[model samples]
Target: MKIALIAHDEKKKDMIQFTTAYSPILKSHQLYATGTTGALISKKTGLPVHKVKSGPLGGDQQIGAKVANNEIDIVIFFKDPLTAQPHEPDISALMRLCDVYLIPLATNMATAEVMVKGLEHGDLSWREIVKEQEGNDI
Candidate 1:
């Protein structure tokens, strides 16, 4: 499975800890993230994360594009609902794309944990079947 990790500035620390805790399970999958979050995860957990620009600079949209194209299976985004984001529209678009593509999205740590565990327990094999069907359409 391909997983995308993203976090708002206020939630970066939590993202780090969460990624560290799940690194063992996560290491087996292809990982992608926004710029600073990716750098921090790589430095702290030694996970190889493909990175796009910072979120405010368009990373959210980049990840959204992958979701729209059916390249990413799961999205974990730690949003700071208390604060205002300059890129709110982009974030909304990303979430909308995930919904449109039927990609699983975790906006908080609890859901993220469930998604990761689901990946570990072979619960996401359905994604492979879905991908195969998508290929047939092409």
Candidate 2:
């Protein structure tokens, strides 16, 4: 599975800790993330990650494109709701793309934990087939 990770400036530390805790499970899959977050995670977890530009500089859109194309199966976006973002529209678009693509997205630590746990348990194995069959049914 391909997973994309993103974290707002204020939530980067949480993202790092989350990635560290789940690095073993995550090591089996391909990982992609925005610049600073990716660097931080890679440094701490030693997990290889494809890094894109910073979020405000089009990183979110890059990840959004992957999600739209079904190239990413999961997205863990740790957003800081208390702080206003300068690139709010990009963030919103990323979340919207995840919904449109039917990809699992976590916008906070609690939800990210659920998603990561599901990943660890292999609960998402049927996602692709289910999405395909649902499309045919429709």
Candidate 3:
């Protein structure tokens, strides 16, 4: 499974903690993340991550493209709702793509915890079926 990890500036600490705590479950799969978030997670947890641009600098759009292509299976974005984001449109597009593609997305820690656990238990194996169907269509 390919998992995307993103976080707002204010929520970066939380994202780091979450990744560190779940490193055991996360290390088995591919990990993708936005710039600073990816750097931090990699530094703290030593998990190899494919890093894209900073979210404000088009990382969200990059991830959205992956979702559209069915290359991403899960998204864990720890957004800071209290703070207004300058790149709101990009964020919205990424989230909308997740919905359109039926990818699992977690906007908060609680939801992320559940999704990570689900991944550990193979609950997300359905993504492979979806990918196979996509290939057949192609």
Q: Who wins the lDDT comparison?
A: 3
Lowest lDDT 10-residue stretch of candidate 1: 116-125
Residue by residue across 64-128, what tens digits does model 2's lDDT show? 99888778899999999899999999999999998887889998889988987888898999877
| Runs in model 2 lying further than 4 Å from the true structure | 130-138
Candidate 3 TM-score versus the reference: 0.98
Better candidate by lDDT, 1 or 3? 3
Model 1 CA lDDT for position 33:
98
- Model with the higher lDDT, candidate 1 or 2: 1
- In model 3, the clashing pairs are none
Candidate 1, superposed: residue stretches over 4 Å from native: none
Q: In model 3, where is the ten-residue run with the lowest total lDDT?
A: 129-138
Task: Give TM-scores for every candidate, taking all chains together and pairing residue i with residue i.
Answer: 0.98, 0.92, 0.98
* Number of the candidate with higher TM-score, 1 or 2: 1
Worst lDDT window (10 residues) for model 2? 126-135
